[model samples]
Target: DKNEKIYVSYDSTNKNCKAGDIEMAEYGHPKNDVGAPIINYSIAYDMTNEKPLLYESYPGSIVDVSQLKYMLEKIRGYGYKKIGFILDRGYFSKANIQFMDSCDYDFVMMVKGRASFVHGLIMEHMGEFESKRACSIKAYRTYGMTVKAKLYADDETDRYFHIYYKAKKQASERARLEADLDRMEAEMDKIKG
Candidate 1:
């Protein structure tokens, strides 16, 4: 199904221009301050819903967990509880994850490589599945469970918990592709010359 949608990005700086402010040039005019004095807003609209839900916003360069929690609470007050929170890689910190866990919220967060250090306990358990030819890992926590899924590249059905093996193979394939491309480019240059 196709639906028509329009989105607006709201900011805190929308001020009306007065003749005196324009003439005096001391207070910034409306043109100078594009959207001043308004609250920041992000909204996602579903045609089925009677009203749009305000999903996200960032007032400044950095947003702390407290600011996010306040924004979410305000949104939840409007009767939107089934919320999915998303953040850029810059906001991928241990403190933020802990906050999410404490608040009993589910989030789809960008997992930066460095953030994996927080899951060192999981990494340490990798060796337990080394001998198994095919396996998957399931982790239990007081809150919920995590499943580390793996599948074979050659055969989709043949999945295993060989983390190191998969990572090394992927890297090797990438290196091989780069080498092949370099060789092919050299050949192309020779033919052109």
Candidate 2:
């Protein structure tokens, strides 16, 4: 099972509990409108088997970004070598990327579109694969192209970025942005009047 893929995600939800001796019950970011104490928990899921491999609960004050290293270590302790992780944008950070590199773990993470590194890459490779039929993924209805580059200027390792684009999504986002701009302009005009 060394070659099996594992997708890890960390999330927490609030639990409404009275003032009691529950050690992990503390106030943190509430995922819902529960006006009570909360506890943060995370699960490491095995993607290949579609089941949870491990779970851990911690104090509510702990954030998900800070738990990546701990979770990676726990997974390693379970004797899983050659691990692959699929993470969300919240886990995308320079330190996390470097740590994963050090551990020799493979990861596919979502990066914020507005990040300067991502923006630069998009601009550099714009239109290269947008219309290329060879890059089209019919099932996902998106065009994907992989580029190998350093995640940071000082990094010694090169990472593979699977950049994807969908024309319909782009058009929809553009329209929404235009509508927001028009609304803001109208509000400004009213203020001036």
Task: Name the candidate that leads on TM-score.
Answer: 2
Q: lDDT by residue for model 1 over 31-106, one digit each (tens)? A: 3454432233345443344445455544332234335556546645655544445554434555555555554455
Error of 2 at 191 (Å): 5.2
Off by over 4 Å in 1: 1-52, 55-60, 63-67, 81-88, 116-122, 127-169, 172-193
Clashing pairs in model 2, backbone N/Cα/C closer than 3 A: none
Q: List the residue pairs that clash in candidate 1.
A: 12-36, 12-37, 13-35, 13-36, 13-37, 14-35, 14-36
Model 1, TM vs. native: 0.37
How high is each candidate's TM-score?
0.37, 0.82
Candidate 2 per-residue C-alpha lDDT over 139-178 given as tens digits, one digit per residue, 9 for 90 to 100? 9999989999998999998888888899999999999999
- Compared with the true structure, model 2 gives a TM-score of 0.82
Ten-residue stretch with the least lDDT total in model 2: 5-14
